[model samples]
Target chain A: MRVLGIDPGLTRCGVGVVDGAVGRTLTLVAAGAVRTPADEELPARLLGVEQGIEQWLDDYRPDAVAVERVFAQHNVRTVMGTAQAGAIAVVCAARRGLPVALHTPSEVKAAITGSGRADKAQVGAMVARILRLDGPPRPADAADAVALAICHLWRGSAQAHLARARQEFARRIETARQAHGL
Target chain B: MRVLGIDPGLTRCGVGVVDGAVGRTLTLVAAGAVRTPADEELPARLLGVEQGIEQWLDDYRPDAVAVERVFAQHNVRTVMGTAQAGAIAVVCAARRGLPVALHTPSEVKAAITGSGRADKAQVGAMVARILRLDGPPRPADAADAVALAICHLWRGSAQAHLARARQEFARRIETARQAHGL
Candidate 1:
């Protein structure tokens, strides 16, 4: 399945697109950033971000979307911006009936670099090597977006398996309960 | 002018519409809440909010929108949700080229009541009186939404005046500079 990954930010929202499924060769589709002027008011800036994301969605038509889950542990101001920006991406994807998954920063790191504590450079290096690029995607935000896409391709498949297994287990339990009339 | 007020939340988003100017008697057009199930995922929850806000905007066609500004000082998790919910409202209004203003909680309270530190009950009572209602609007969220609408009718006017004054001052300074060839 094709996936669009978003690294949400108010000033610069990083975006990347990739095509792949479990045990499949990943194809790099796009990498870019949606930038809004810092001096603009919040409402206008958010609208700009929305338009940029919509353009990408219309251009790529990805089957699923992956967004970096925002955490509140950092600077309060920055955290709020991240959450707001992330909301725009989430709402856009959900509006289209697309499957949207949010992966935490550590999860993205570990999925790509095999270590949750991997620094930016290590993660960037891994993304480059995995994508078969000469170097990491230009601009750190683009690199992060690519990493997030790659992470989702790997982890989303695992999650799908786990969900299916849970459903099967629940069905078996219900069947046994009905058989005993309990 | 008609104004729509939004008190953003994840589970229940308060919404109200009022028609009035700063010195005019306020007319309540609508008061209600847009509720999303708590069990819903974040993306779907946000989409729910976006749809709710869009419905209001389409139904009322308000000249401006007033949304409660979110702060991050208390409860980081809750703050993120509030910010996210508020972003949906902001984006919806901005998409239509509508003027969107954000008022802090204290500002809304102070504009409706005599004190910024007014309790919820006091604010509710004042909102009922100012709007000449028999009682406050139903549900705390609905009451707050109405209060925010009234607050915007008052405070938003003052802000517009200040903005016009600043613009006029800048224009005069620019004219003087052009005359002096500076």
Candidate 2:
């Protein structure tokens, strides 16, 4: 399965796609940043972000999307812009009927580095190791997005497996009940 | 001129429209709310908001859009949703080249009731008086949106007049300069 991850921001929205399945080595499909000019008015900049996200969706067509869930613990104005950018990403993915997931920054880092408190450099090193890259993706932001995609692939596949197992168990119960003619 | 006002929220987005030019009696064009199910996932709900805002824009075709400027002082989670919703409206307006303005709750209150700290009832009352309504729009949320529209009309018209005057002055200066061959 291919997954797209977004580390959303107004000035630079990081986007990365990885092709992978459960317990499989992931392949980097694409990685880049979508940008809006700082001088542009807020509404126009927001529109630009939306257009960029749509372009990425058209180009990659990932089976699922993972976005960094925004939190309110940071700089107020910047966080607001980040949240808005994240929303645009979410809306774009949902419009196309693609599954969307959100992972906190720490969650993504932990997923990649086995520690929630891992710093950027550590997380980047681990991500490089996981994907067998000579180094992490050029920019730190894109690397973060790539890590988020890896996190989703790992978690989503596990959940899908559990769901399928549950379905199979229910089917067996129904079949046994019918065989008993009760 | 017509103005569309949006009070952004994830659960119940209030929308209102008003029609009037500078120094004229304003008419209440419409007032209502757009809703998204609370149980829906964040991405799906955000898409619903975008669709709702698009529908309002299509129906009203207002010259401008006025959305409540979201602040980070409120409940953290709710504020994030509000900010996201506000961004969607701003993007929709910008996409259509409609002038988009953000009015803070306090600023809207001050414009309508002569005091920034005026209570909701006071703002609603002033809105009803200005628009000649028996009472504020049925829901409090819609009333807030109507007030925002009125606030924008008053402010936007003054700005437009100033801009027009400046342009006309520049034209006269150019004409005088040409006559003098300067």
Candidate 3:
């Protein structure tokens, strides 16, 4: 399945699309950054980001979306913006009825570089190597987005399968219990 | 002018609409909470918030929107959710070409009550008095939303006027410069 990954930020949001599934060779479809002027008003800036993501979603039409899950940052302002941007992406995907997955930064790095502690450059190099490109995607944000897509393609599918299986198991048990009239 | 205030939260988003100006007696047109199940997935929860805010905007058609600005919290998860929910409100208003204002919690409290450090109960009491209600709005979140609306009506109008004055000044300056032919 095709996956679109988003590294959400107010000033510079990263988006990448990849075609692949677990145990399959992933192919890069698109990668870029959505930029909004820092000097612009917050609402306008967010609108720009929202419009850009919508454009990407409309163009790429990915099967699933993966967004970076924001955690606390020492800089609360930055963290707030990041979380807001990520949340918009989530809403966008949900509106389209697409399943959305959130991957932590460490999880993305580990999935792409075999180490959760991998540095930016290391992860970038690995992304390039795995995608069989001449070099890493331009701009660190784009590379990070690509890494997020790769991580979700590699790891998220299994998690989704597990969740579905658990739900199905519960449903079967409930049916059996009802049959027993409990 | 009519103002819609939003106190955004993942589980319980508060929304209120008021009609008044800074020097006028504000009337509460509507006040309530948009609740999402805590057990829902993050994307679904955010979707609920987005839709709720959109519905409020559509129903009230307020001239402006005011959202409670989220700050750093000891609970990072809660803060993230709040920020995301607030962002959606901003986006919804911006999409409608409505001006949006953000007031910090302390700012809202100070505007409604006499003190920035006022407790929720005090703020609630003050909101009820200012709105001339028999009692404070039910559910602390709803009161907070009312507080946000009152705060914006109290302060945002002046800011808007100032901005308009500045724009008019710039326009006159530009016209004079053009008349000088250089």
Candidate 4:
């Protein structure tokens, strides 16, 4: 399965795509960020974000999208910007009929580092080690996104397996119905 | 000056335009909403939002945009949707080189009514009375957007006055420098 993970921000959004199978090795396909000028008008910034996401979607074509869920904060402006970025990810994933999985920061950290309170450096190190890369990803945001993708890959396999089981059960039911002429 | 107020949402965004001058009465120029299919992919929905905002911008040509600032909630999905909608509004205003102002729900309520804790219905009623409209604006969201625009108009005028003062001061300095051959 191919998974695309995203860390959304108003100024910069980091995205990573990973391809792999359950109980098997995973590969990093693509990674980058969409950045907008801080001084630019909000509309232009959003357009830059949209265009960047579109390009990534077209290029990667991941089967699923994993996005970090927005967490509540005391700062209204920061919360607002993060929320907007999160929405862009949802729109991008929803438009393509790609199933989206949301992962909280804690969940991703626990999945990757076996600790819910793992710091950025720890999570980045874990991601780099797991992916068998030379070094940790730059711009911590990007590394977090990659870790989110890894978490999804680990969790998503269970979902894929369940779906396959359901399909097989439906097929068996249909075969039995045919035999009974019902 | 003409001010456009926008209430951003995932499925629908309400827009209202008001025209007025400082120390003069404000008039509602136009009001409507842009709706998108919830089931469509996120990108398509975003495109719909962009087109919708573009149409309104072209039709109204407002001097400024006033958008409601999104607040973070416990529901990550809902928060994400609101954020995306907010970004679209920002992008719409920026593309036309129009200044964009953001107002919190409480701020808009306080501007329309005496209390910041006023509910949507009370705020809608106040908006209708303030705008001298025939009736309460349909779709409460649309009325809230109008209120937000009114708030911006009031606040923007104050900001403009300060900006103008600064510009005049700078111009006087330049004139003095030229006269002194400095």
The best candidate by DockQ is 1
lDDT string, candidate 4, A63-168, tens digits: 9889887766536667666667777676677767788878999999999999999998889888898999987776777888888899999978878889999999
Per-residue lDDT tens digits of candidate 2, residues B1-182? 99999999999999999999987899999999989999999988988999999998999899989999988988888999899888888888998999999999999998999899999999989999999999999578889999999999988887889999999999999999999999
Off by over 4 Å in 2: A164-182, B164-182
> Highest TM-score, which number?
2
Q: Give Cα distance to truth, residue A101, candidate 1, Å.
A: 0.3
Going through the candidates in order, the fraction of native interface contacts each one reproduces equals 0.96, 0.80, 0.90, 0.53
Error of model 3, residue A111, in angstroms: 1.1
Q: Write the per-residue lDDT of candidate 3 for residues A30-54, one digit (tens) a residue.
A: 9999999999998999899999999
Estimate, for each residue in B1-182, the C-alpha lDDT of model 4 and write its tens digit.
99999998768788899998878998988887888899975666776886788899999999999998776753656665667777877866876778888898888888779789999879888888878987767676688778889989877777888999999999999999999999
TM-score, chain B, each candidate? 0.86, 0.88, 0.85, 0.85
Cα TM-score per model: 0.88, 0.91, 0.87, 0.73
Residue A19 in model 1: shift from native, Å?
1.5
RMSD of each: 5.1, 3.2, 6.0, 4.9
* Order of the predicted models by DockQ, top scorer first: 1, 2, 3, 4
Candidate 4 residue B181 Cα shift, in angstroms, is: 16
Off by over 4 Å in 1: A160-182, B159-182
Question: Clash pairs of candidate 4?
Answer: A42-B90, A43-B90, A43-B91, A84-B83, A91-B42, A94-B41, A94-B42, A95-B41, A95-B42
Residue range with the least summed lDDT across 10 consecutive positions in model 1 chain B: B21-30
Cα lDDT tens digits for candidate 1, A1-182: 99999999999999999898877778788998999999999999999999999999999999999999998998888889999999999999999999999999999999998899999999989988888898888778888998999999999888888998999999999999999998
**Position B168, candidate 3: lDDT:** 100
